[model samples]
Target chain A: QQQVRQSSQSLTVWEGETAILNCSYENSAFDYFPWYQQFPGEGPALLIAIRSVSDKKEDGRFTIFFNKREKNLSLHIKDSQPGDSATYFCAASGNNAGAKLTFGGGTRLTVRP
Target chain B: NSKVIQTPRYLVKGQGQKAKMRCIPEKGHPVVFWYQQNKNNEFKFLINFQNQEVLQQIDMTEKRFSAECPSNSPCSLEIQSSEAGDSALYLCASSPSGYEQYFGPGTRLTVL
Candidate 1:
């Protein structure tokens, strides 16, 4: 079973618009959630993250809205730029799992200028 | 702008041949993790280490895959015998603590 799951396989939005990507997890033990952005041929880079305690986290134009009770989260890219086009992965980790991360399949995002 | 470094960005190995990849964690980071990403973008955790001691590893890694993070040396992951199923991008990440990890430009391994 997939512990982490991404709702969309892909998402498209116009430049300057907000693109939202959704994710969910099955394991209640997961307390830390992180979003990673990956360009072609490169490894995933940390974008934004939230702990179970916080309902939201923001970094520049990237925002993560987390609902711990629902076991779901969403990444909102405000003022989306063409340079933001890439695959986004949502990963989860818990105290019991140490540092091991369980990642979702990923959502490929495209921003049209 | 991650400082984690991985060598041999690409490797092509024949079946049954040995494949090795190396990773240098970020300076002052004591925790290192290895993961395999397949064509489908599925990530499989291979192993992890804190300093020179291993913390956890999957079953596959305990078998044909061998990994070591020696003190003052770059960590390495070696496949005893390559297989088509082993072809994937190997990613190395380092963490200051254990929550947020910084990833390197992975090494892509192709087995034929």
Candidate 2:
């Protein structure tokens, strides 16, 4: 069973538009959520992260809206640019799980200029 | 621009051959993690260590795979015998506080 899930396999959006990627998880023990961006032939880079105590986190044009009660979250990329095209992964971890992360399948995003 | 460094961007090994990869964590980071990413982009955690002590590892790692993080040398992961199923990208990450991790470019291993 996949502990973490992303709603879309791929998503496309125009430049200047907002692209939202959704994610959900099964294990309630997960308390820390992080989003990673990966380019071709490169490892994933941490984009943004949120603790279960908060409902939202924003960094530059990227924002994460989290609903702890629902076990779901969304990443919103505002003013999407072609340079932002990449694969995004949602990962979760908890104190019980140590520092190991459980990652979702990932969502490939494309921004058309 | 990750400080973590992984050697041999790509490797090709015949079946049953030993495959080894190395990772150097970021400066001052004590926690290190290894993960395997397949062609399908599925990530499987292999093992993790804090300083020179191992914290956790999967069953596959406990068997065919061996990893060690020495006090001053770069961390290494070695497969006892390579298999077709072992083909994947190996990623190494380091964490300052164990909550957030930064990843390296990764080493792609192809087994025939």
- The local distance difference test score of each candidate is 0.95, 0.95
TM-score of each: 0.98, 0.98
Q: How accurate is candidate 2 locally (lDDT)?
A: 0.95
Residue runs of model 2 more than 4 Å from their true location after superposition: A96-98
lDDT of 1 by residue, B4-79 (tens): 9999899999999999999999998889999999999999999999999999999999889999999999999999
For candidate 1, the TM-score is 0.98
Q: Which pairs clash in model 1? A: none
What level of docking quality does candidate 1 show?
Answer: medium
* DockQ for each model: 0.69, 0.69
Taking every candidate in turn, the Cα RMSD to the unseen true structure, in Å, is 0.9, 0.9
Best by DockQ: 1
Summarize candidate 2's per-residue lDDT along A35-99 as a digit string, tens digits.
Answer: 99999999999999999999999999999999998999999999999999999999999964347
- The CAPRI class of candidate 2 is medium
Q: Ten-residue segment with the worst summed lDDT in candidate 2 chain A?
A: A93-102
